[model samples]
Target: MTASTAFGQAAATGTAPAFDAARALALAQETFDIEAAAVLGLKARTGAAFARAVEAMLAVTGRVVVMGMGKSGHIGRKVAATLASTGTAAMFVHPAEASHGDLGMIKPADLVLAISNGGESDEITAILPVLKRLGAPLVAMTGNAQSTLARHADIVLDSGVAKEACPLNLAPTASTTAQLALGDALAVALLDARGFRTEDFARSHPGGALGRKLLTHLRDVMRAGGAVPRVGADTPFTELMREMSAKGLGASAVVDGEGRVLGIFTDGDLRRLVEKGRDLRGLTAREVMHPNPRGVIRDDVLAVEAAELMEKHRINSVLVIDDQGRLCGAVSSNDLMRAKVI
Candidate 1:
């Protein structure tokens, strides 16, 4: 059968032709190459206009209102989110929705990032006058600089692509890629200008893995009070074993009379004791323990830091001490893993 006939039959019967793996791979690579070239082209275009956009956004007292339609609108939402997460206050406002009532969200002190590849989205252009009336500065990201949206824009960012990756050049493939990359460039520039740090990013993303790693403290995951496997320095070796077993921490802290940790007795220590054939029946915890064991103070140490400390020392657990050098708690690598901060 002819290729067109096969395609038609497949469309009608909901069955595709035998997949050509090589053709599929070639097309995918071509698409990637096209999009990559489009992004590379943007590097040279990053002149005064890009700098002006960043400055405008940085100077704004209010949020950035991102406006677009269809595929551009989808990209706008992501851009707004990136800006918001990276220290710039931003929100996506669909141009169509703005025409009805959402335009109220934009204020005079705010800046508007209008996206339209053709520079002629009716929904976006329809509200340019209203935005002007509100005194909101317009920053246009468009392909056609002479188009209506670009002509009226306070700052024009050229986001034109050589061509779409789509075979027919009908879809918003390369154009959308360029727009997205430009949006990211704006966000990263704003991020650097504001000196946005990982801690600040963690604050904005407390529910994610990065947040958990950076925000969660050692104290938050450490076992304290009765849960911590602690024993007196003079505690019998058998009693130390009981403490370790009872807490299920695989280790026990040998503390002094004042509740200050003096040493640590781990499963490895126990193994060494067995290998040495030491008579544990009458031994004290201090005799078999590793003195001045590695530990951290319960201050502002992050869980990820604690995990790193444990890994560096080749230990599974560490005693958590307070400013006064008293044993406050204990944390294990397992705790960090469980908290998803490792």
Candidate 2:
């Protein structure tokens, strides 16, 4: 058979020759190249309209209502999530669902972001008149500048891609990648405009490790009251060892009569004493303990900061004190590891 005849047969049958490893790798590389080039082109498209879209979203007192169809809808969902997590109020509304009854989700104060590659999605364009009547500003992301959605939009963001990574140009590939990138850009720009900080992100993601690092305070994870291993400065060395062993904190705080922290003694100190063959019979806490040991205020610092302080001082534990310099609790590196702040 002729090469053209074989190609026609394959296309008609919706099948192609089996791909070997080298061909598969080459195709994957080509796909990445197409998508990367498409993303690079977006840098020049970020102009006045992009800035206007950000301003419009920021100006709205209500949430951003994102609408799209099919693959664009999937990207819109992610965009909405990113915006909401980054301190912007946003939610995705399916165009078909909006036509049914979800249009109620859009308020007069809300801003609408509609995505359609061709700028002619019937489901999305059909609602433009309604959005206009509701006094909601419309921002359209599309490749076609003169399409219906673009023409009716208050702000037009050109997300045009030169080609699709799909060999047949039938599937949404590079176009969707461009849309996703533009959505991320919008979310990040709004994040910067609002001066969103890491703590703000942590607040939004309290279940994650970063949130634990930022929001967990020393008081929350410290051993307090009776659980803290502490002894008076005049306590005998045998009593101090018993307290340290019972508490299992690997260290004991040596404080004065009023419970003000004076120093600390750890297993390392015991090792040094043993190596010197010092007599424990007459030793006191004041003689064996480290003077003016490092400590942190119980409620004044985060657990992560306490961990950093431990690392800085090369110590395994720290005494927690109150504002008036009274010893209140103690925290160890184990506590930080358990809290997932280490």
- The candidate that wins on TM-score is 1
Instruction: Record all residue pairs in model 2 with backbone atoms less than 3 Å apart, i.e. clashing.
Output: none
lDDT of 1 by residue, 1-342 (tens): 533334456667777668867656666877899999999999988899999999999999999999889999999999999999999999999999888999888899999999999989999889999988999899999999999999999999999999888755678999999999999999999999999999999999999999998899888898988999989988888888999999998999898899988898999999988999978899999899999887555645887887888888888888898888898888888888898987
The digit string of per-residue lDDT tens for model 2 on 1-342 reads 533344446678998777457655665777899899999999998899999999999999999999899999999999999999999999999999898999998999999999999989989988889999999999999988999999999999999999888766678999999999999999999999999998899999999888999899888999999999999999998999999999999999998888888899999999999999989878899999999876555657888888888889888888899888898899889888998898
Segments in model 2 whose C-alpha atoms lie over 4 Å from true places: 1-16, 295-298
Instruction: Please estimate how well model 1 matches the true structure, expressed as its whole-model Cα lDDT.
Output: 0.89
Q: How displaced is residue 180 in candidate 1, in Å?
A: 1.0
Give the Cα lDDT of each candidate. Answer: 0.89, 0.90
Q: All candidates: CA RMSD in angstroms?
A: 3.4, 3.3
Q: What TM-score would every model get versus the actual structure? A: 0.92, 0.91
Name the runs in model 1 displaced over 4 angstroms: 1-18, 295-299
